[model samples]
Target: MLKKILFALIMSVFFIGIVSGCSESSDKEEGKGSGKQTVKIGYFPNLTHSATIIALEKGFFEEEFGKDVTIETKTVANGGLFMEAMATKAIDVGTTGPGPLLNFYVKNKEYHLISGAVNGGAVLVSAGSSKISDLKDLDGKKVAIPVIGSTQDVMLRKALKDVGLKPTTNGGSVELFASAPADTAALFVQKQVDAAATQEPWGYVLENQAKGKLLLNWDEFAWGKDSPNTVVAASQNFLDKKGFSASYLKAHKKAVDFIQNNPEESQELVIKHLKELTGKELSKEEVAAAFSRLEVTTNVNEEVIQEMADISKEAGYIPSADIKGLIDLSTLEEVSK
Candidate 1:
């Protein structure tokens, strides 16, 4: 009787050990699925990307993503690098220009414009000494763009087209310089470029720091307020994560609301964030000035984006502008609803 009792105890102990081991293994597998992971986001350090800035600074992403996920951010000087990072899977979701996103989407359908960020925060400025009083003056002068084929570049091309001028790349007289916006100011000070197509507060910076003159205001620029300057983009794999899109868009919408509802505070926040990112302390003047030209909203106009794509194709940036599946706002619609 003692031996039988001892054998029963041993069997029970072994079964419990197996069950405990299985539970632990299952837990580890679950962890691999969603327990802990790092999410990488990318954006340019421009006012046009303020939604991303505010989202990060205000901790909206943290609140939505929770404690289990880590948020990693990468800031690029130009849209070309931003899209390049997306292509290499360096970033999961963040903000970028509609033009760069569309141009890249045409070549590689690996990403989608999840939502609209900010619209019409860009302008065309001529150096104070360049004697470029109007668009036609750009015909024989050098123009700086954030990047070749960027949103600003496309806008510059359009403006040039209106004036019967074109970038040398397009077989016209205007000389195009592909420079980072931050560096474009130095180009102006050095007389390296006569004009620049850029977004604020860089436009404000050019006006103040480099004595740049605004040749075309935001509304006067291509598509004006209808132009999709900054937009939310996401890699396909990241969008595939369960509930990730909803969480991200929730944070994005929250940030946009903050920017809209709290105007003065939002301006200061942008100034502080810009200083932190660029090491340049911007005044309320430029921040407010940039804010004036910008419309922060979650509404993305597909018709405007389609127009941008058409302009891109006309400029030979892409073979065709058929971005049929480039925009998948189903998640955004669901989240908004």
Candidate 2:
């Protein structure tokens, strides 16, 4: 009886050891699979940031991570708020125009232009009763922008000045105000505002449904056809961590591939996702037109980014002295996957 009892105890201990070894191996596999870090991404629902929406729908992030990961989304009421979030490290990555990024950098904050999000989607629209048929006609008009320090605001200021009109002066030639993009479009429709410089899908909505006419689609005014309207940015700290940024860049590359390869399918997905998040579907025409106006490329055009910086500087959004060292694009070169 004593021998049988001892034998049973020995077998139980051996089984437990095997189970322990399997658990450790399983954990290591999971660690290798899931990546050593988590990524929190921030993006807007507007067409300016359609790439992010399409990316999420297509499972690009998941493919890159090779395991379960967490993805977070937040809506920035304006570019100022977005920059504030970046400064505080509330998000690891974000998508927006270069204007805000440059401005933030000038203020001594650091961020990396990790990848490209979308190209052009910006447009200038005038209310039906407004006499603005071109940039030349924008003289002496009140314009609405999503925010004072936003990319649209900077672009509008530059476009106006390009036409020989001063935005802040020249006999009150231009009055620019800040409001949400959708709200600005509604105000344009109500005739409370003469025009608005806005990014896509919003530009599409205003033109098609609100009786606004397009003064300039993206190509005509800002970066011309292939300009990088939105870029993927990351905190410097996030970039310094091992393998985290690589995983993010890999995911971003997949997103670019998915967008370029499957635009039509991506558009459908964007509409569905946008509606779920925003409570409305972008019209088929809007999606089609907006997509046409945008190029989904990961190259952050240095010239265009510099132009955005110059615009912000000249417009008094950022001091001219700070423009030179505003960009920390080194990481851009690092993660150009």
Candidate 3:
């Protein structure tokens, strides 16, 4: 009788262990089945990121991702900060300038450009009273760019070098000051800076409100016309997840379409969101003038991007970069189909 009881107790203990193991396994599988619970998107507040702003304001991302997935949007001031968010996995996807995006991609081959957000909208502006008339006049004058390694910065550096001038940082004649677009506009208005190479609608603000002059519209510059200013990109981790990339691209395409089909309404949306993000409300004329300078589209021109990469490399902003792998338009194409 004693032996029989001992054996039965041992059998019961063994069965309990098996059941516990099975339960743990089932829990893990359930966790995997749940997939990603939240999707974090990062973007700049500039008009170049209008697609991201409009999509977030319109609930297009939420509607596409459904209620199960929480969509969180983070507004970054510059492309460099946006890339930092991506590096830390704080943002699953982002919209940034081609300059910062290419620089990041060269260092960390973990992100890929999924689509283009906006093209053009950048300008080289000088104070109305300034003697600077063109890039040639930029010699020995103080010029402001949004950020040191920004798209505008890279373009300005190359343009100045081509004009036989150089940025102060790069041992040249032009004195470069890296300031926020708004601050640049204010400085230009106050006559604190000689010239500002900045993006629109801040360029518009500087020209109209700040009494600045447009020295060079972006179209006249290399890598300007239909160039990729802002691009939508996703991290490798996000791309590894099922269904998330597709949903994101779908919403992005929709936002681009909305921008094209509803111009006035889209401008209003951009204005409203810009106010919410930057506390700066632009007038209808200002917004319209800004839009006239920018080409908002979803098409990613690989050749233009490659040219940008080459420029960035030549400027020593990045090491050798193979941009072919940096671009993955398959997802965008799939969404279009």
Predict model 1's lDDT versus the native. Answer: 0.88
lDDT of 2 by residue, 1-337 (tens): 9999999999999999999888877776545433544567787777777777776787777776655566666777566677778787777786877777777777665676767778778888898889778777777778888887787877787777777876754344788877787787679767888898888778888887888998888888665665667888777777786677677767777777788898888888888988998798778888999888778877766667777777776677778534554445555466662
lDDT of 1 by residue, 143-249 (tens): 89888888988888777877788778778999988888879889999999999998888899899899999999998998778778899999999988999989999
Model 3: per-residue Cα lDDT over 1-337, one tens digit each: 9999999999999999999888877765544334537889999877888888888878889888987787888888998998999999888996898888889999989989988888888988889879777779888799888987798887787677677887766677888888998887779767789998888888888888878888888686546676567889899999998888989988888888898889899999999988987788878998888888888788887877787787678667888857768998888888899
Segments of candidate 3 deviating more than 4 angstroms? 1-36
- Each prediction's number of clashing residue pairs: 0, 1, 0
RMSD of each predicted structure: 4.4, 6.5, 3.6
* Candidates 1 and 2, the one with greater TM-score: 1
- The whole-model lDDT of each prediction reads 0.88, 0.75, 0.84
TM-scores of all candidate predictions against the true structure: 0.87, 0.83, 0.87
- The runs of at least 3 residues in candidate 1 whose Cα sits more than 4 Å from the true structure, single-residue gaps closed, are 1-34
Model 2 residue 121 CA deviation in Å: 0.3
| Better TM-score candidate (2, 3) | 3
For model 2, name the residue pairs that clash: 140-173
